[model samples]
Target: MNRWFMTLLASLGLLLIVSGCSTKKDEAPKDPKAAAYDFSNEKSFVVYGEGIAPVHTVSPAQAIVLAKRAAITDGYRQLGEKLYGVKINSSETVKDAMIRDSRITAQVNALIKDAAITDATFKDGLYSIRMEITMSARRWHELFSY
Candidate 1:
């Protein structure tokens, strides 16, 4: 009876393992908003970012340049977030069943290559930039392998 029970348990475990195995190619993005875009119909991803001129800038030209640089940086950050999902760390302290302190942090790390700035404009002391990157099905896998 003991040997029969062990065999049955091992078979069930093996079945579960086999059923859980899945290929990475079919896995979809975890973010629900990702569903809005029909990636199958498109070959690239697009992101936009805006930056405002700081009050302390010396000249209008300098302010414009600064804002444009900031806008480019913002666009890159957005790309990183989309490619590599954000890492969130949270902690909470409870005293007498009441939460005393809580903290949450998010971080993203990604390597963006061959991204092109399609549109850029400065208006009313603000700079806006649109960035697009060409991504292939297997392109992302090559990014982190290095």
Candidate 2:
């Protein structure tokens, strides 16, 4: 009986080890929205006719704040549903939040392909990002109205 029990315990341990080793790695998703922007022209340059204004630069602190705020504004109101009315769990790391936020932005960009949301740039502190999007008035109306 003692030998049988030892054999059973060893088999269970081996099974658990094998099962754990078979766990798959988490894959980073390829964004379909990004696929739309892929092209052969890699060294593209913007030509200014001395008419366009320069772009603005946002600081890191401002970027983080903007990112958090934009996450809420862009239909992700789940963060605010906790008892505190706006509870971003203190235990959650900023890196984890940023990764999730980036994924959300990618998915949203995919759905709004007509808008041609080509790219996004984030400053360090801002929760919001500056997005480059192109779309006709008709397309915009159709998207939001639907």
Candidate 3:
């Protein structure tokens, strides 16, 4: 009887230790490549854009595809806004002008011939995209010279 009781106690202790040392399943996995890029340099610019597609008559795969396409287009628009700059009439605040009359905002006419897509992600039914734009000295001179 004494030996049986000792064995039971040892088994309980072992179970306790094993359960306590287990890692949490709910913890988010870390991405090693997320921090690989440095955007502090003034020579380069980074922009992010996101798009959400409503679940309508389309299947899940189709929805995701549409969302990704929208995200890429939105990213390009954001990059164009950053590069060409948005013009608003002085008579009204930019926000008000945008809300009341979108025509007040100058359209981007300059061509963004090249843009690098840094990252693309989909989570919680929304698609997000990141873009990086680098302007060389010659490109800047060409843009201004025209």
Give the winner by lDDT.
1
- Tell me, what's the RMSD of every candidate? 12.9, 22.8, 17.6
lDDT of 1 by residue, 27-103 (tens): 88777767544346435789998999988978988999999999999999999998777899999999999999999
What tens-digit string does per-residue lDDT give for candidate 3 at 1-146?
99999999999999999998896865644664432232333356688878897779368888888888888888887777877877655444357446543334456644676678889999998999888878665556457544
What lDDT does the true structure give each of the candidates?
0.84, 0.40, 0.73
lDDT over C-alpha atoms for residue 45 of model 1: 80
Kindly provide the TM-score of model 2 when superposed on the true structure, using C-alpha atoms: 0.22
Candidate 3 regions with alpha-carbon error over 4 angstroms = 1-42, 89-106
Ranked by TM-score from best down, the candidates are 1, 3, 2
User: Which runs of model 2 end up more than 4 angstroms from their true locations?
Assistant: 27-146
Candidate 3 residue-wise lDDT at 146 = 45
Best by TM-score: 1
Regions of model 1 farther than 4 Å from truth: 1-42, 138-146
TM-scores for every predicted model: 0.63, 0.22, 0.55
Alpha carbon lDDT of residue 89, candidate 1? Answer: 99
